[model samples]
Target chain A: MPDTLSEATRSEFDRDTSVRLREPGVHDADLSPGWAIGHALNGGYLLAVLGRALGKTLPHPDPFTVTAHYLSATAAGPAVVRSETARAGRTLSTGTASLFQTGADGEEAERIRVLATYGDLGALGDDVRTSAKPPIMPPREQCFSAQDYPAGPDATPEISKRLDLRLDPATCGWAVGAPSGRGEMRGWLGLADGRDADPLSLLMAVDALPPTAFELGLSGWVPTVELTVHVRARPAPGPLRVCVTTANLAGGFLEEDVQIWDSADRLVTQSRQLARAKLD
Target chain B: MPDTLSEATRSEFDRDTSVRLREPGVHDADLSPGWAIGHALNGGYLLAVLGRALGKTLPHPDPFTVTAHYLSATAAGPAVVRSETARAGRTLSTGTASLFQTGADGEEAERIRVLATYGDLGALGDDVRTSAKPPIMPPREQCFSAQDYPAGPDATPEISKRLDLRLDPATCGWAVGAPSGRGEMRGWLGLADGRDADPLSLLMAVDALPPTAFELGLSGWVPTVELTVHVRARPAPGPLRVCVTTANLAGGFLEEDVQIWDSADRLVTQSRQLARAKLD
Candidate 1:
């Protein structure tokens, strides 16, 4: 595992998301299996990849908003990230990226497509006005660690192990014999590799939990068909707070809205994702 | 006005969104001043324009989800929508489109870029599960029509005149001398043209209202920096109920989350948009 990289090497995230310029608006990156659910890559991790590529392609330094559409299931391997800058201004730069993996027949398949706007989080200003309350979660010590219920390699998603995720006992009843039908999940999320959470890392933190529908007596790897992320503020170098709530599941389509509050007690990101599900 | 087009002419929406294929993956459509805020086109109308183009380029018929990033302020005139298919499956197809308008430099400048997933709405089975409550509002007749507070061209947007939108009296206080300071806007939206509301038109309906922050006692047209639309169901042929709420206004950036319910009392669209609001 890349977790034990020497101090001379980059952090697990910086290393995994690092990309090389192949040409203008194109880069080469490897889809690290460690950041995936089985052979399927994590949607947030994919966004992080595109974010990194976009961060490089555009003049802005931080990814302010990202909307990704998972066109097809991805395999863990080498992939090409193609980026394009649509608009570059002083405060905000908008761009798009597509991740492509070549198949055995020599055909390049696009796995994920993204549209993002980048800006300096430092310039986002301190004018915060919010009417919504943050999720109420116990200290990280009180909540049970997701590692408590470790499924085998075939079951437990690798992405979960790469992050220190603790779930609210009230919402994790589904993990045990009893299931809660609330369709909500709250937790404290931190990189298991000890990588400090940033706007880019927050991308991985948003989708780093089991589907909220699991509490509704549904069990399976819920794949995200599409995800939209709004990065409001920069994280304050520590484990962040996370809450995932699913309000609707119609026609086997479920929408999960997530909120991430950094350790400083600031809401850094708000995301809503649409995923397909099978009612049992 | 084209509102009274003869029976042979297409409806205002159908005519405005109709696109002509210029070549493979390219389309030509004129931006109508009627579907705009002053000179800037409405964000949702821009999405519908791209939706119409995507609807033609992709194999599927209906757009299930659309995410648009407004790169620059778009001017009403002749523009081209360029689309590319990323994937086409049996159930869903994904594609991207860019609306480009030629500037005085004779350069084709990209204005709005979109990523959308299309599917057959007819195949979306009737399995709806939602814990969220639809907005409660009085009957349309009981509510005050937006036309009641109409302003001159420089004051009221042209879009308001083209749509028979009715506002909840409780929230429209900002339009008058009194400001509500609740950061919420509830209204019933329908085309003045009486073009029956469908899935495509619902795109325009999602963003047809003034910024919810107007109730916060702010003025000026709020420009949407980014928008994401989730189409879960088809319309039931009537004025759609719309409720927009702004939770946080941080650094002059306000997040407006919207819910649109059709006449059948089903949630047809859920959208979240990030717009820049300069506080007075």
Candidate 2:
């Protein structure tokens, strides 16, 4: 088992092994609030997991863009799910994943839909343009430790797990440090070793922003309702800074639009997420 | 110029001989408050113009769907613009239009982006499914006219120009029978001619919802900042209704969500808009 798993990058996480392409089921411990006891799982977390799964399916040395929006919230158990590549064309390939979960009362609680497109840059003509440059920031070695931002006692085990994170004063990055029994979480993220550049490496860095920003205020309280993200472009790995400019809060919804720029001052990628807010 | 004008089928509008595929270059009369001026002329009216132009380019009997979203507010004048087809397949074609407005001071005030898709139903392989199924309503001959509703002076001009609308008792359908020359106004709308069918036809009946629902009860009125709309399915034309569900107001900004449904109990499209709120 250990020999076969080495192909997947090793996560900083110690307790929970990084999910493998062969793994078909998610642990029950990952289910968080807004999730019925009988609920299937978190949609946002599922999206991330599926992203990881689909990312593995793409050919190596490929660049792809994955975008997802919630059609309806779904819960866990009994309902079936299947992921398939509809058209894996020579230049561009498309993949879809569908998740279905049934409730305790026999009603369907959720449905998750994902569409991913993988592309080979070499095959296309050059038409490259970026709106803004990526920002430069502090290195991971210079940042503070995870203990300083401890997850509260009541914090879902899914979130309390440690993460190796570093911020470019302007951008946020992190890598999974420990197994989070909880379904999903966000916080400072970065690599312990400093190596970067791959999509997974960037995602490991980008996904940490939400938890980190919210934690700055809560210190321990509050949880997210849902998280929706889009990657507009990819940034280079280096001593870069990212700035999270605006966080719009209205009604019971919160939306954050963040942009990451590489050290070259070229705009890298833009990301936005919507989450239900809770005052702790 | 006199010979180019022709009576439209409804006898209420004049069809110009010169199709306007671009934004208006000349100044229009100053518009009143509460009126969706850009929408009336650009999004809705201008589309008719584009259809006329495209009609000249393509063969007759070309079925297409036009979707427009206001990127910024505009004033009367020549706006640099361009149109291009992003994708042109045998069965499906997508076109995008961009408009840029330069003010008297040579400052650009607004940029408008529109995307439209043209399709031939006969091409798709035996798969045509429409989700909306609104209930039937009484004929136009039996329904009461806007003469029965309260009218505001500035609302007369727009109110007078009405469309055929019908709504089931559960939903709200709005239209202005005779719009006055200025400010915001409202009146119930449904089957002006009292035609009944599934919700698909009803989809074509209603344009965007008015901004009145969000401004009601506020000390100051609100002006639109920007508006976006999407038509998921073409619903039948009758008994349609709209109910203003909720509005988020803060920091002088307002966002409203409206739900439209047909007589048959199917929830149709949901409309949303954003605007700046101010005191009347």
Candidate 3:
């Protein structure tokens, strides 16, 4: 019994973000190094974990579109995922995956719920192509490390260590108490561990940037009510350039749009999320 | 037995768009009067039906955020809905609902899959409020009926009858064989059935507008890959003022953002979707 228990713990700790199917429709995942904003795990990290689980259950290999609703803040630890196939078609497959934290009584408490679509982008051939100019920014060598800025009042220091973000100085006005008078933020994003940018990493990049609402003179925790991401193309091997913008802020709600361009200058991922402003 | 079967058929034909739950986690719905584009049922109408089913399964009555991925074009017929509760929190509940068409062999073929979040929007309390000006548009009386324009090569007449749309003439350049040079469409929208605008109606309204890509001189069917709608508030009882805009159209893909305002001039729903441009 002791040997079996030790083996299970070692396996859980080894693959923190990877999905391992424990049985059909059930998965075991570990959230290590624990990306958190205060005590709550980062929403994107939880999404990536769930995405991996959904991808495994579907026939396709790429998650072309994914949407998540954060039911509650989750703590970092061993989590369980249960996925069910909603539809399986010739070109696309859709499903839902739920993440849970087990209690001492063996009860599972839900954290985040996601709906995702998996497809083969290559199968959906691109028949029409036009160039939408990417956002302009200084070269990577000229940008400043985003780590220099202090964490948000609700953020933890581990965020900087988990994701390496370098900001365009001109758009970093919010860091110095001066906003650009526009809700926008541009930066270069990559994993701090120097891993290649994949679909999961791009998901994290979509929410990793500083909230665009911060530039509108708003502060504190801006919780995302819902987030939707569209993966256009597989990213090339390099840092991704990201631009986040919010055009409307009203009714205590704001919508943030993010565009991620790969090193090859190809638009890889596009995401938009609606969130509530935590203002006193 | 004959009378029972006849009564079921009458009930199914009478309320095609209304949601009627047959049991916990299961629902019986019809697709009569079939909201169709040529032969396929409209995606938004399907979403509304699925959203209604999910709302019934959750503790909350309002579905504030809903997303749908159209797996395959569906036909008008009897359908079954299976909903699973993913998370039932104190303030919000997230779940998945799958719609299927029952075949002659009693096989259920999945048609549409949805992820939805239900909450007590009124209970959330309006603590923060700021106004964002609604889109600029000519009065409803001044705008022309979109029906006068010929349906797109890919559009069907059912769209015209499903929603009464009045377009701002200046933005309808495509209707007269001229490109607007900008990716935008502004108009007023309301149900053809004259039903009051509720949260479910607003979900349909988000996708009711003409494809913004048409204004950019792109023609044919621009199919939505995925759509995400965020319900900010319960809309007032009147035609909704709407604006749909796309800033980037590249590589056969475009993202459209929509803002919906009610009769009281308050922003009620915001939506964003990614779609493929079927240019000839």
Candidate 4:
């Protein structure tokens, strides 16, 4: 691992996404309240908890790609992840997981369904070289920090308090109810607790910022229906630059596309998620 | 149902994506040669096959979104789809499937893994409206049809025979060794069997075009590693406009983004896929 794998990265992230084996294919996890927006937990954090179960059950060590479907919003608490391997190839292993939680109706509800593939990413491919250009943004110091956002009563969304997320001030109009109508968001993201982000934590980073559609006048936390994440190269621990943009928002449905550039300025991750949000 | 659901749509599509229920969660499907490209079945067509199994095993009527990870390429032959429903509620249903085929080593191999959600699309949203702009292209009459491409020894790709896929002539340089290096493809798509395209067929349509990276001078078929399709609305029966583009290609990997516009000029389907291809 890179020297940047600080003690904080290991302990804090493990605390956030760690899972304990219950049976051969089942694991138990505690969804931390520190990762919730309002009452619902972040979708990417949920996927990481599920990823932990899959990463342990499968033969591979790193996740190559993962797709998660949010069946229903889940609250933070004890959850069970039922994971099973679908394929165990020489270099790649595939698995499916479902996180179940007890609902208000006293029913065991499966909150999220995830399909992921794992592999030894180091041996997967060559060095990074991309024709894509990095997202343009002001210096981190000049950007509007989510931490400093004026919180009226809600206590700065518990989730934001856990991350060092700085949004481009030009794109921060939505926070003030003056949306720019541009379906995009650019930010610098890292763990506020000094935990460096690894490939697994980058899963959470993809969704760390406010929804890009929020800039288009959509309010509240737009629920993600389905999200697909592709991890190309693991980042050398540090803050990751992120760009989230959307082109289609029709009939209260839209898709958000994300790109995460590592400290070396190479594209390291990409994701597209379908979500539900209403216009202002 | 729309009058566009002609007998051809029902019969031809059923023949192509049909799955015979073997049990509650298992289905047997015949891999159709008509849907193969140089013996490798088209990724979108394969996704349609998996969607067929999940659509039947689950309670819902329409597939809202599906993400498929292509583990290994399978040739045309007998295959089994082992599908299991993870969640089945009133409004939505989720399921996972593995399409297994006999490999050259005489062992059954899981060719692909698919995760999908189903719901009643008709009741899902409102009328058509979009902020996305349709892809620019010349009139259909001036474009180059995949069927008319010059065949060298091998018959025109078997899969192209199955659809009326037209490519914008300006972007066709990749076909004759003079690539445009733009990494984009614009075209019109429709079923050659005269079958109308519904929301289900849009799954296949998303991956129906030649890999857009071809314009960037990448040769041969770019194998898709993972593909996610979001179906926003049921498309009307007609030739659909499609735009396929990629901005990031590094470490021998790239992500393709596609948008499909319906007859009414409304965005109907969107997809993002990670594929592997080598530059010439």
Candidate 5:
């Protein structure tokens, strides 16, 4: 038998260079929506970090999918994140996090829950089919940055570092530019600056497609009302394909379905979102 | 000045045929599988009654689209169903229901929630583009009935249902011939029961199309995993057209997307479902 080390003798920090640890925070500017008030961290921002944290927990480190449902919001104030492992099945793992924001009077203000699942690379098979194919879009190299757009000029430092994207004429590929051995695309993803890949980071990569799919003349911002993603398996170390299709848009809402396939033409995950599309 | 009726003089329940009520223990069946434990009411039955309830609550009763989700089973015990108006906005109206069955412990065993919304019709335009074309199945008039394939030796109620279908050789019009209009079918459908021309009832008529889409072998039990329907607008009180595409089946599940179009090629509603396909 190999020699065993005592608890105090072993270092708590990870020694391997390939492994990473993440830190999440709530900034001051995250508030001001005024719907639930006094809190600085918005649901959208927390949602972004949740996706990043989930992606970081995957075995082979491939970003597959993330989805969140707004159950009920805590009142409005300062908050902390609480995560619990729900189930650790053989092939699938699920993690749940509840955002507990604290109020000025030292009471719980608002609460939000997130459920995310991770899996290994072996879950997909050879058969892959989709009714709607990804339409051609601007080249990844030529696509404009979110800062170039008039909506959120301040999105650069946060959004730009979050995803390293590669766009063909049709699909956008974003992740840390790594080779996912499964023949699928892979890259560095989630909040850049080495933050945990959480729900918001997943949405940032997922939402990047719709805006770029149009010709240069369409001017509008389609904010999502709800986004639901189902991942069949987790990613390995490479490029993941994200394909999006618009189901139907009527009145003030439009539904879009995005399918994220691995390099080997295997289905990894899929997402469906309904957005409120309006002229900016 | 307008006169208002006193509470003592005003009526609560409708004496006329303004609403249709379905009492508990109406359509109980023990043959339901594990996923659907309680009695499996006809999909059309629920659609018809729910539509009528909406018509009575709205201002003009001009709703055209109604969608249902999570088409699963309730508990195996006491059964109860109640529907009430949640909120009514200018362009949209919302309603909800609590459906469940009682348990052996004298309490509500399982409960399901149904949320529906209604919207006014959109302006008709000629650009009618739909995913559905005419089906390849047989036409309606020349289909065969139960007499064509007598259950012969295997004469269970389930066998009789399989034998009693009227199928068109071309479009494969498979239907369980019930005079109540609550049966499965393939091929083209015309309103033979002559029910009121309302959005809800029309949607019910469209939802039952899956089981009949194929011969489905000898099993009388076709289980729906989940169903979602969206109607753009209500059609005139006339015949409608529907085309279905059984896209794919995997992991013990099959999915079909149906497009309901009015005679002149206007999209009426889109319906789809994931179901457990059985050959027993």
Candidate 6:
């Protein structure tokens, strides 16, 4: 959509272009290209918009944690974000942000409701330290490009041009008739423009992978009902390793847990979401 | 506190006593005896109160998902709950609730911000069903009561009388000088009064376990910054099994994931929280 890949990535994240401050604690955000799952805009993309607004209104510079409830599906357009500071403490601040759109009757209807906590991750200090090993992944040269997957007739071109993903063959069995028999997906994710990953990009990357339930032989549109993202740390400058796992899929509902590790092999973000499973 | 363990358990969950309706969409709740970690009340206990209020206001009878941001520590006293319906869909509803308390200046101040999703768990249907097996635990007779651990001079008696916990010896290394190389705490949890486990109790049980970081030799008040609970199903009447594990602890912070299983061997709830690591 933009002249260069870097420009496109920057445009996607540029608050001035994507989110325009209309007034104090209120803003208008543009739902641009490439951040969509089918026709509806991606949930994480919306979260990033709301998070940016919350970050500006709150005292904190980074979004430590954000939980968004998808009220209704929204298409590409201009949306309004209204944020309120629920609590402002010395170390942490909590608030609520509601993303709305104009209805046919000229009334504002909410499409996404967000609750978030913001703080300076670096300022928290490091007295205790321990970390689990990152998920083992094959070298980028050996992995298959997710971009190579045959696009459906209705597939949007912006998706492939926006996100660069290399899938781990072992967990890509869903592509063929042979399912993995396990609910998991592994891939390497980076902005197509080769931009460095940040807290906001980490939020978008958590939902970039295909639904892990697809590996369990469940198909169709799996719309998320609620999603929660925990920003563990800022990412180093490089592609991020991604892993998505599902522990349970029952009663037409499933939960997906996503883990993102920066190039430095440090865990940067973790998220879990509950979505309605569309089964054949 | 209530004369007997049964009475105490009932009192903790008695909506009429703990939650008093002040007006439409407004409620006053009490943070009472035995639910405190020290001077501040337990995060899960506060969640149960807010969840109960949200469950009453939303059309959905069950709280399928809830995420709360702890802005500041709350003490034992009366707090007000204000709830707003963000979206009222046909099958699911999203809402926000803020718990507030009177400050020294006699002004209402927010303590906790909650984002929740409510729906009819039963009505969701059972077309596609799968579940991860519950964690392996010894019989109740073989496990040791958490109460057996000698309390410090500051230990609150209400914690012991409110919850009956039988620790899994394998993960209970923190009780002694030996620390589990891995950050984890496993045990069986139930109401001391022997009430049947439900969604509300399940919410409380998720946070009832001691911080898993303790097993990693990190001690002190590991307060949660944010907590999210996903109610998978209705418990089948009995003691619930619990497992708390931490995958990463860095930058003076860690994330704990909690899993709960009902007596009938069903995974009733799963939760994840980000908390500050209080190391010695």
Query: Where does the lowest 10-residue lDDT sum fall in candidate 6 chain A?
Result: A1-10
lDDT of each: 0.85, 0.38, 0.77, 0.83, 0.41, 0.80
**lDDT per residue, candidate 5, A135-247, as tens digits?**
34443446444434434535333324333444442222222222121112222223223333222334444554433213211235554433445444434434445655553
By TM-score, rank the candidates, best first. 1, 6, 4, 3, 5, 2
lDDT of 2 by residue, B1-280 (tens): 2224354442222222133333332211122222234334323333333333332333222323333334445543344445554345454344444455667798754344444444443332322222223324444354434343345434433423434422222222233333221222222345333444222222223343344432243434344332323222333455555544322233344444334555444444333344445633
Question: Interface RMSD (C-alpha) of each candidate?
Answer: 0.9, 17.9, 3.7, 2.3, 7.1, 2.2
lDDT of 6 at A122: 78
> DockQ values for all predictions?
0.83, 0.02, 0.37, 0.58, 0.09, 0.64
| DockQ class, candidate 1 | high
- Give the C-alpha lDDT of model 4: 0.83
* TM-score pick, better of 2 and 3: 3
At residue A59, give the lDDT of candidate 2: 49
Better of 3 and 4 by TM-score: 4
When 3 and 5 are scored with lDDT, the better candidate is 3
Model 1: per-residue lDDT, tens digit, B206-252?
Answer: 88988898998888778888998988988899888999998888887
Candidate 4, what DockQ? 0.58
What lDDT does candidate 2 reach at residue A89?
Answer: 48
CA shift of A263, model 4, Å? 2.3
| Candidate 6 regions with alpha-carbon error over 4 angstroms | A1-12, A15-17, A124-128, A151-157, B1-12, B15-17, B127-131, B151-157
What is the fnat score of candidate 6? Answer: 0.77
Q: What is the TM-score of chain A alone in each candidate?
A: 0.94, 0.57, 0.88, 0.93, 0.50, 0.91
lDDT of 5 by residue, B109-148 (tens): 3233334555565532323323334444454456544344
Question: In candidate 3, how many Å is residue B17 off?
Answer: 2.2
Off by over 4 Å in 3: A1-16, A122-133, A138-142, A150-156, A170-174, A177-182, A248-252, B1-16, B124-133, B150-156, B177-182, B216-218, B248-253
Summarize candidate 3's per-residue lDDT along A118-237 as a digit string, tens digits.
888666554434345688999877876744665652343466667668888887787788877677889998887677788866777788877887777787789988889988887899
* Chain B TM, cand. 5: 0.61
Give candidate 1's whole-model lDDT.
0.85
lDDT of 6 at B123: 83
Please write out the lDDT profile of model 3 over residues B167-275, one tens digit for every residue.
8888888888886878888899987667668887777777776788888888778877688888878888989998888866765778888889899877888888877
> Candidate 6 residues B46-78, lDDT tens each?
899888877777888888999999877777888
Error of 6 at A173 (Å): 2.0
